[model samples]
Target: MGKVTAGLTMSLDGFIAGPNDGPDHPLGEGGMRLFDWYTSGDTDYVVPSGGMTFKISSRAAEMLQEVFSSIGAIVTGRRTFDITNGWGGTHPIGEHVPIFVVTHSVPEGWDYEGTPFTFVTDGVESAVEQARAAAGDKNVAVSAASVIQQCLRAGLLDEVHVDLVPVLLGDGVRMFDHLGREHIELERTRIIEDPDVTHLTFRVVR
Candidate 1:
């Protein structure tokens, strides 16, 4: 059996990105404050939901290794993929992992280490179905704010690992925005109090 999940860093003030966001300001003004947790070195591939920073500690690393061990494919929102690939320039995802992108329209050329990119616009379910098929005997990783929120709303996410950094953006983007007035249960929690940042992991139980 396979499962889907999402993990993101957030602030005490509940902001994933700073204000003044746009295509030009991907992270938005002072948005980098949410990324302090990504200093985890070149090892961990930090995926920020709503652009919050969460440090990767030894415990978090071990947990991530455990969870990501069987990963065979990945899915992300268009904006997230664009920003990440644009930053990577050449190699992205650190490996030749199959990726499914959610977008209304396909771009001219989207390449990351020559890996194939598939665009999905039908819905989150359709995207996950394709990703799971491509994933084969491995776990499919969901790595975008909008995608995760959709999955969570659609009751698709199974587990999530997140690291919480110490910073307050005051405003910007948020990962759990569309969750609406529904109450989401907090299944599990792991707190990492490193000097650099405070990391936390949550396993959401639907």
Candidate 2:
């Protein structure tokens, strides 16, 4: 089975998103700034106006690329799927990277024109199992903060990588809030420092 891993860029204050995150503001107000490290690279993404490109530092881009290459499938939340407009019908992760969305109810005609999403309503464990099966030997990556927390609490996640951006969002959705009393063991596996952000990886000690 493929390893279940998750990664995200977060502010020092621990928010993965800023306030008022919605369809109009996907990452929330100024939340897009958190991903400056990745977008700084000449990475192309779909925007409302059309395709846009941004450049990040070469070293930061290279490190981000390494993480992107290992993901075979992605698991995210319904809110995330909605906020991104299903990644504008072309997932930011990749066109071929299948997404398994955990939701309470699968929407009618859930599949988009070019992008099809697998909606798992059973629970996070079912979503992870299906994502793992779809991923084959590569890693199944959890992208949304809520889903990442679910994986952590369920003890299904194998690794976590965070690009710790040097900023603070005083209010917003926190990444590690209200996780209950369960303790998850972690071992630092890698660290890469850059002027914009620091990339850190930790193995989930089993």
Candidate 3:
């Protein structure tokens, strides 16, 4: 079985997204600052923000590549999937990697020709099971915080990775909200520090 993992780039204040998140503003207001490191050289936002165009450290680059390479399938919430518009109606990750979306309602005339997308309305657990099967020996990663929280609360997540950015959003969609009263123990697995962001990985101790 494939291990279940989740990753999110969050602010120091613990928000995964900023206020007024919408279709036009996917990351939310000022949320793009959290991903500045990953998109340093891109011409789109770099020039306007006046952020320095610096190369990501070798270690960070290697770690990111490894994370992507290890994933065979992805599971994410309906909001996340819809916000990205199914990565513009085709799996942006790749044509081969399968994407399982957890949703209450399936979209009309859903179609992504080159890539495979499975809409699992049953629940997070069902979506995870299908993703794990699709992943085989690789990891099944969830990108959305709601899905991650669901997996964590249900004791289905194996690992949680966070790219901790230095900025604080003050108020927005928090990553660790509404987890109920259950206490989930985590063991530190890995940590890679960079000037812009720190990569932290923790194993959910069951």
Candidate 4:
């Protein structure tokens, strides 16, 4: 079995999408700022490794790639999958890792860029089961809206890598929209600041 993780770039105000998110503007106005950490390749966001070039060139991307490399499967909500556009519809996983998208309506066999997309709606847990089974010994990563929340609620999230941007969005699609009354402890926090953004990692303690 592999660890399940929820990783996302968030704003200081605890938002992932800006206030005006929609079909016309999925990211919303000022939304892109939440991920400035990646665009600038700020060293502050880069984790200390053997000091490889890929680590410094694109820390977020490199981190994501490393994370994905260990992934045997992925689960994401419909809306979250849509955010990636039709690109994911045809090729859900960029690295050929299997992806199971939890959605209400399943198309008559969805295929993306030679990659097969399996849509499930039995429930979040069901999706997780299928993903984990398919993943076997590899990690199963869950991304997108409600899905991450559901996992967190189920006490399924083992760890998370957070790249905190240095901005505040007064209103937007927040990351923890429904954390409820439970409080989680932070195991660690690291800062990496560049001209574009600041990276912060917080390990979760249940």
> Lowest-scoring 10 consecutive residues by lDDT in candidate 4?
46-55
Instruction: List per-prediction Cα lDDT, in the order shown.
Output: 0.69, 0.82, 0.83, 0.68
RMSD of each: 4.8, 3.1, 4.8, 5.0
State the lDDT of candidate 1 residue by residue for 1-206, as single tens digits.
56675766667666666787656666779887676656653345343222333346666556655665667778888887676653443223344566788889887666434655788889889999999998887777888778888988888877765556567777777767888888878666666676656666667776
Query: Which is better, 2 or 4, measured by TM-score?
Result: 2
lDDT of 2 at 137: 91
TM-scores of the candidates in the order shown:
0.79, 0.89, 0.90, 0.79
Q: Which candidate number has the best TM-score?
A: 3
Better of 3 and 4 by lDDT: 3
TM-score sort, best first:
3, 2, 4, 1
Off by over 4 Å in 3: 41-55
Candidate order, lDDT descending: 3, 2, 1, 4
lDDT of 4 by residue, 21-118 (tens): 76666767878777544444434432222222232335555555677568788888887667656443444245456677888887554554565467
Model 3 accuracy (lDDT, Cα): 0.83
lDDT, model 4, position 23: 60
Q: Which stretches of candidate 1 lie over 4 Å from their true place?
A: 22-25, 40-56, 85-92, 111-114
Q: lDDT of model 4 at residue 156? A: 76
Index of the highest-lDDT prediction? 3
